[model samples]
Target: MTQQELQARYEAVMMNAFGAPKRVFERGEGIHLWDADGRRYLDLLSGLAVTGLGHAHPGVTAAITAQLGSLGHVSNFFASQPQVRLAERLAALTGHPDARVFFTNSGTEANEAAFKLTRLTGRTKVIAMEGAFHGRTMGALALTANPKYREPFEPLPGEVVFVPFGDEAALRAAADERTAAILIETVQGENGVVPVPDGFLAASRRIADEVGALLWIDEVQTGLGRCGEYLAHQADGVSADLITLAKGLGNGFPVGACIATGRAASLLQPGQHGTTFGGNPVAAAAGNAVLDALEGGVLENARATGAWLAWAIEALGHPRIEGVRGRGMLLGVVLTRDVAAQVADAALKAGYVINAPRPGVLRLAPPLIATPEDLAGFVEALPGLLDAHG
Candidate 1:
């Protein structure tokens, strides 16, 4: 079917939550996608930073198929090998082998679980960063600071506070003995790939400790090697009581995990929280496959290629280009003018996929497996593309 036909069908049936469809992509491989019209485009957004292993990776496909053929899902009542193994893998990766895992189906659910876990600390107050995007759910939505996203859904959960991102003094002023948890994104992905100011995370840790609150790090977009590290907060040499993950964990598979470490692991007792399909074998197998791919040099490739891309984009010194923000593959191309949406649309016409998360910020989260050559092509084309659209 044609892209227009598919779009018309989608608009007629699906909710208009995401506005009109951009294009009907039929298939993808590596860092490339083919629309219904058979035109190819390099995908730099990685399905909003979920497809870390790229599209249709052989190992992930094989793992999911094998698991489905054997034992797809057994619910949370029964123990599944893949589920247990993936939990162990995540525990180890978090630098806390004893950390407990609560698997969910999406990043929003993971954050929800963490939100509940924080309540178990005998405190109702939670402090989140400004410009944060936790999720659309009621509990997560309360922590999200965007007025547009929160205003429509009033009467959200109460006692949630928002402070300036990376402002140690603001955080300190907002946090107190009543604060149950201090939630933060190591790198504010939804806020234009903005990394926390250096030493800010460590300070938050100290503040959380002082107030007897849990330090929750939301790594939904920056974890699982997306930022050239297993967890972005690792660079700060501080560990969080709760770490929420999704996005790249399952390499496009619908899976998320809320990991609780130290004393926070035991907060949610039996029957307090659960999911029927959270740790099903299929998703767990896919998660394992992603971990395997990352261990097999994908992480190193991200570091190398990401640095190259950042340097190349900055080296261009294009008149419209302001600078680059973010670490590793999670980058935001800041523009001098508020034409990010125009640039993104022009990029689509030029056979590329990117996103304008903010008015003047173009977010790029190419697959971790993307090569320097692939990025170089985007770099070479971006200057001219910006000139045409900027």
Candidate 2:
């Protein structure tokens, strides 16, 4: 069917919460995507950083195909080899060998699982950072501080205190014995790619320890080599009691996990939390393939490309650019003016794709496998795109 016809059908059939579709994508290969009209654009955002291995990655496809041919899913009642292997790999990569994982199908579900884990600690208050975006689920929403998103759903799970994103003092002052957990995003993706200040996460660990609260870092957007590391928190040199991951875990195959470490791992017993589609064989195989490819040159490529992008952005010499923030492949271009949305739209018109999380912030999280040449091409086009906004 035509793009317009499909869009109409979507509006009729699907819920309106997400608004209209951006463009009807017919196909994708590597970093390029084609709309139904055959217009192609570079996928810089990588489907909001979920497609870490890029579109149609051979390894991911092969793993899914092989797993589906054998045993696709048996629900959480029956355990599968791929599921167990993926959990083991995640626990190892998380740097806590004793960590246990609870799988879900999306990042929100992972956060929900972790949310419940906090409850098992016999505390209810959670300290969340301002400008945080955990997810839209009720439990995740409680931890999310934005009023525009949370105000609509009032009387939510209460006792969530919001502190400034990078202020260690405010966070410290807000914490006490009543706090169950302190949740943070290593790099705030939806808040326009804001990274926690240096020493901020470590201080959080100290505070959590002092107050007897669990430190929970949400790596749903920055994990799985998205920021040139297995988990972004690893770069901070701080171990979190609970870590939630999803976006890049399965290379867009739809999987999430809540890994709990130390005493936190013992919080959730069997039947306390479960997901029907979590840890399915097909999703686990896809996750394993992503982990396999994350090794070797793929991770190095992400680091190099990310570094190159940051340097190029800084070198753009555009008077309108306030600064560049974030680490590795996850970056936010802070415009001096509130022109991020216009700049992103201009980029799409120029055969590139990017996302504007806020009016002044343009976020870019290209595939980890993006080539240096592709990086250069985007860099070369960026100045022109920003100028077009002028």
Candidate 3:
């Protein structure tokens, strides 16, 4: 079918919560997507940092097929190898030997589980960053900082106080003995792929320790190699009491996890929290495959290539290009003017995929598997996009 025909079908059946469709993508390979009209475009967004292993990855596909052959899913009442193995693998990544996990279907659900854990601390107040985006669910929404997403669903889950994103002084002032948890996103993706300031995570960990509150780091967008590390806090050499992960966990297969460490590990009792099909065999298998790729040097590529892309773009001498912020594949190209949306739209029309999360910030979160050549394509076309749109 033509693009217009597919778009018409989509509008007829789908809800308008996400606005209109850009293109009816038919298929993807590596870091490229093909639309209904068979136009090829470089996938720089990676489905909002989910498909880190790239489209139709053989490792993910093989694992999913093999798990389906053996056993697909069973109730949480009974344990499965894939599920247990995945939990163990991710827990080990925390570098905390006694880490525990609660699985969920998406980042929001993972945050929901973490929220309930906070309630178990016998405290109701939560300290969140000013530009953070946790998720859209009630509990997760409570921690999200944007009024636009929160005002519509007033009377959110808890008494959440928003502090400046990287201001340690404000964070210290907001947090106290009554604070149950301090929620920090390693990188504020929705607020324009902004990485937390240096030493910010360590300051948060210190403040949480002082207040006797859990340090909950939301790694939904920055974790698992997206930002050059398995967890962004690893760079700070500090461990979080609670860590929520999703997006790239299953490489496009819907799965998420809320991992707790130290005393926070045993906070959730048996009946306190549960999920029907959170980490079923199929999803776990997919997660395992993505992990294999991350461990097999895909992470290194993200680090090196991401740096090169930033330098290359700046090397263009484009006056509109102010600079770049963020680490690894998650970057926000800061434009001199508020033409981010225009540049992104022009790029898409020119057969590349990126997004404008804010007025002057263009977010680029390509797959971890994206090579220098692939990003070079986008950088080469960036000048033209800016020239036309800026």
TM-scores for every predicted model: 0.99, 0.98, 0.99
Number of the predicted model whose lDDT against the real structure is largest: 1
Alpha-carbon error at 125 in model 1, in Å? Answer: 0.6
**Candidate 3 ranges with C-alpha deviation above 4 Å:** none
Question: Clashes in model 2: which pairs?
Answer: none
Residue 73 Cα positional deviation in candidate 1, in Å, after optimal superposition: 1.4
Each model's Cα RMSD: 0.8, 1.1, 0.8
lDDT of 1 by residue, 60-93 (tens): 9999999999998888889899999999999988
lDDT of 2 by residue, 1-390 (tens): 788998999999998999998789989999889998889999999999999889999999999999999999898889999999999999998677789999999999999999999999999999999999999999899899889999988889868999999899999899999999999999999999999999999999999999999999999999999999999888889999999999899988999999999999988887887788999999999999999999878778888889888888889888878889888899999998788999988888778899899999999999998977887888888878877776
The better-scoring model by TM-score among 2 and 3 is 3
Q: Residue 160 lDDT in model 1?
A: 96
Error of 1 at 234 (Å): 0.7
Residue-wise lDDT of candidate 3 within 172-283, one digit each (tens)? 9999989999999888999987888989999999999999999999999899999999987787788899999999999999999999999999888988888999999999
How do all the candidates rank in terms of lDDT, highest first? Answer: 1, 3, 2
